[model samples]
Target: MDTTTWTLEQVKDRISKGQEIDERVVDIGQNTVVKFADNVSAEEGEATMFIARMTSVPVARIYAILRDESDGVTYIVQEKLRGEPLINHLPTLDTATRDALALELQKILNELATLDKGHMGLFGRPSQYGSGILAKFDPPVPPIESPEDFLRWLPHNVRDNYGRDEAPLPTGIFDFSRPPIFSHGDFVPENILIEDGHVTGIIDWAYAGWYPYFWNDYIARRRSTLMAFQDGKWSQMVGQMMQPFPEEFRAFQQLYYRADSLL
Candidate 1:
């Protein structure tokens, strides 16, 4: 299956016909897979490939990035990785295996933390469209440089869109002066691939970017708590692997709630 030859209509049709499309990439009856990004610029696809190449962490091999001239949608062809998502197997793993997996996760996180672009903001270059929280708006918000700036930006942006006359007050005082670190914004088990008790690759780079040092740990811990019921060995291992930052976590939660209230 030559993905470069596939048209947007054909891809949509195939998807509608029950083909498995993983993160915009579909396996077109061959060993190869094609990733599609629609109604957006090519920045994200380009950034994902760039980050994959730059990082030491295992990731899918990107063969090429193609764009449809008529619609400006991007397509990425890459090697199909061989592994199951860790989330699917976590429940069956013994404590020892789970602990080993947590160690591997910690190592990956540490390596990612070593990646610093010397400034604060989102991971990729500044563009009109971004992912994660930024994608919630049209003409996406600009990458923030500081936590305080983000704190102010959140309420202002939310209120602006909601036609509110005033921004909400902060629930608590916080110092967001810490330097930014590389963050896999959506760092959950589902993004991790494993085979034979070893991590094979990490996928879904759409939300990778520069964020506060505590952001990755906080989000990962929060998700582990949610997915693992806050009592399982998986949750315990995650807590051990990543230290908790209750203050920052609470602040972010409050900000998120305040912003969500406007909607």
Candidate 2:
């Protein structure tokens, strides 16, 4: 949409009556879509805009971010990707196509890795939105400086379940020195858009931020619904595409499995 000609108020009005593409998304026009909701992560717009500025990353181009402060709703208008979600085409994809996509993912992850500025939260400062990693918290966890800090912040119940031998999250394993890398937190097929054999856009960046590299692998595997589809080959593909932090991931799995207890 043309942000120059349309005001935020106008966008808000249009979104209120827009044709629903899904629960929170609307097809605003032939070339754009609008994602609006009271709980939409504000950082998603920033993430998309940031990725749009990067030459290598294939992400939706955010046109405008309008927050209706009075109603606590946020509207993000962004480019409509040319293709459908990778999930839709995964079953039909050939090995060659999947391999190409894997290579593309490797490059995208490399681009994200370049953003190691030591920030351990969202891309920018003072992240108010809850991430997938800590969404169970009522008020949400804030940015932390170290992995130990994150471990200390874990709920006692989940903490108690962990063995003393675990690294990163457990107290015994000591070295928490890995610098946080920028991650797309949710790297499942549904967030990936593919046209032909190439990735056209990576959307739904609500969980995108700086975190341990393992977060990508663990979260991708943990959150993936690909088990029923392709017999879990997609998850295996993601494991190969991202960094492997098997030790840290095994520890994290225990905590994540108990995440609902925090609620």
Best by TM-score: 2
**RMSD for each of the candidates:** 3.8, 3.9
Instruction: Estimate every model's Cα lDDT from 0 to 1.
Output: 0.67, 0.71
| Clash statistics: count for each candidate | 1, 0
Per-residue C-alpha lDDT of model 1 across residues 108-192, encoded as one tens digit per residue = 8888877755345544454222444445765456656766666677777776776764356465545565676777667787888
Error of 1 at 12 (Å): 10
Candidate 2, pairs of clashing residues: none
* Residue 229, model 1, lDDT: 50
Q: In model 2, what lDDT does residue 126 have?
A: 36
- TM-score of each candidate? 0.81, 0.85
Residue 207, candidate 1: alpha-carbon lDDT = 64
Model 2 C-alpha lDDT per residue in residues 1-263, reported as the tens digit of each score: 46666567777677677788899998877677889899886678988887778647877777788788888999888888888888888878888889889889888888878864556665564333255536545444555776555655555423454332222245554247766667776778888888989998888988777776577877776655445554766866776688777677767676655554434
Candidate 2 lowest-lDDT run of ten:
159-168
How much does candidate 1 score in TM-score?
0.81
Candidate 2 residue 53 Cα shift, in angstroms, is: 1.9
